[model samples]
Target: MGIQEIAQATGLSKATVSRALRGLPTVAGSTVDQVRRVADELGYVPSSAAAGLATGRQRAVGVVLPVIDRWFTAKALGGVDAELRAAGYDLVLYNLGGPGGDRHRAFRRAMLRQRVDALVLLSLVLDETERRELQVSELPTVVIGGPAHDLRNVGVDDHEVAALAVAHLTGLGHREVAYVGGEDEAGFTVAVPYLRRDGFTEAMARAGAPVRADRYADGRFSFAGGVAAGAVLLEVPAPDRPTAVVCASDEMALGVVVAAHRLGLEVPRDVSVTGVDGHEYGEVLGLTTVAQDPEAQGRVAARTVVLEAQGASPGPLPPSAARLVVRRTTAGPCR
Candidate 1:
């Protein structure tokens, strides 16, 4: 019913019940649990508006993303949602439609209605104008899958991930390696595609298996794009074709596998294929990859913002883990 009823049931003062309900750090853990049990027994429903009036916090977190349909974005979003829900915080999602979505309107300072206590951004590089607007809000902010300029980030190190993938291929004695990555799409501010590509190039150079200019093709970070890029790279003469191919995403890697089948090229024997991202389909397809957990990244981002919102100064986050998963698609070059 209300804090007053809960306080009576628990024999605790209304002030203690209120503090426990808000989950303030100053409240003792055992007392907080006792208050919650009594409150639940009394069917008490905490009101967000009342909480906001008391604490000047909206009890909500805003999540901003460029799109919603992709595998990584969706998974990360789920993770963020779960964490926020567990913390008794509402999620306010702000989808920017897609690559061509209205940038000016979304980042306008007036668009933020002061309805959220904090913000979690997913892999978007903000320009100067957008940055200023966020600064004006001054909400505790963190980015998932992105390490943009001076923003707290929660994701794998793109450079380290790329190098790990490349090292795996080169260790298998594959010298002629090709790369499949995309450019930042028009109206999109993602830095991952280029970061992975450059990391791949630099890793190859370090391994003494430098990639040729013609050996690289833009996969556009999609299945169709991967298929097209794979075809161009694999359709060449045997001697001229790369013995290994590294894709920036699992969707693209799966596409390359399809392209290989169509071109009558045997994986590992003809060309070893690798990818980044541990997409759900990757396991079924048996594709080797540098797997990083987007869902986990999302959870970390949400937790960090929630803590910061609660007046806790969390330290800098270490990069999320990324490890290579060797599967049937890659083996020592048999060519």
Candidate 2:
């Protein structure tokens, strides 16, 4: 049945019936119940497409991500999905394969088409062309990484998160710390890895244990990368070796642990290790880290975008808190 028929059956105006059916606050509770009952009796299935055409709203939120293979992506998507579903909205995911994918070209046109009501771009540094396009498009958008030119954003302060990890190591009386972070220097995202490295440097200097020139290693943020970099750090003479190391990600830290084991060195004895990212298994692995839940970050970003899409002027999203989780992988400096 149609909205008009439901309105006629309920003895109410079509506008009132529509608002009541949509659960708009303007409609009284009794009126909504009555409309729902009438709609139920008539087997009237409301057309979402018709509603979208009438209101010029798609009732969908687009979530853009850099990759879906990682654990963080899965957790973050879970948060985004739950939040959007609660708001009676659907999620349209767009996974840009990598930094320089030709597939991103499709989104440049699709976003301009205004297909989704709002968008949440995760871990992406928008290029000038895309930024210019999105700015003029006027789509309500929330970014899930660092500050994005005044856009609503919710993310862990990468610098502060790394600093917490460094502080934990230094507090344990560990000096001569090493660092393993990200894919090569040039492949790292604009603000992500650079800010993290900056934090490590600043925190080390504050604790009077500046990173040595040979202590830093660059590789992919992967287990294999960690193993390779960990070997380089451990291969140096015992007297000159760093007593502790900080990794930019959990996987990399785990790699270092594996490397240390293979080299017949006890964890936290030969070399303490710490990392960032709140991977669920960090506690199980007993790896000390500064945990920042990416899933929680996604939820905050979703809330901001959805509220703004519904015409509510929401303020900036709450910042993701950086938590220091102490596990067994870190300890006092090894002499």
What RMSD does each model have against the real structure?
11.2, 10.8
User: lDDT per residue, candidate 2, 184-273, as tens digits?
Assistant: 321224566778888999999998887788999864777789898898898787888888989988888888999898888899889998
Question: TM-scores of all models?
Answer: 0.81, 0.80
- Leading candidate by lDDT: 1
The weakest ten consecutive residues by lDDT in model 2 span 182-191
**Model 2 stretches astray by more than 4 angstroms:** 1-56, 102-106, 183-188
Q: In model 2, what lDDT does residue 333 have? A: 74
State model 1's lDDT: 0.83
For candidate 2, list the clashing residue pairs, or say none. none
User: Which candidate number maximizes TM-score?
Assistant: 1
Cα RMSD for predicted model 2: 10.8
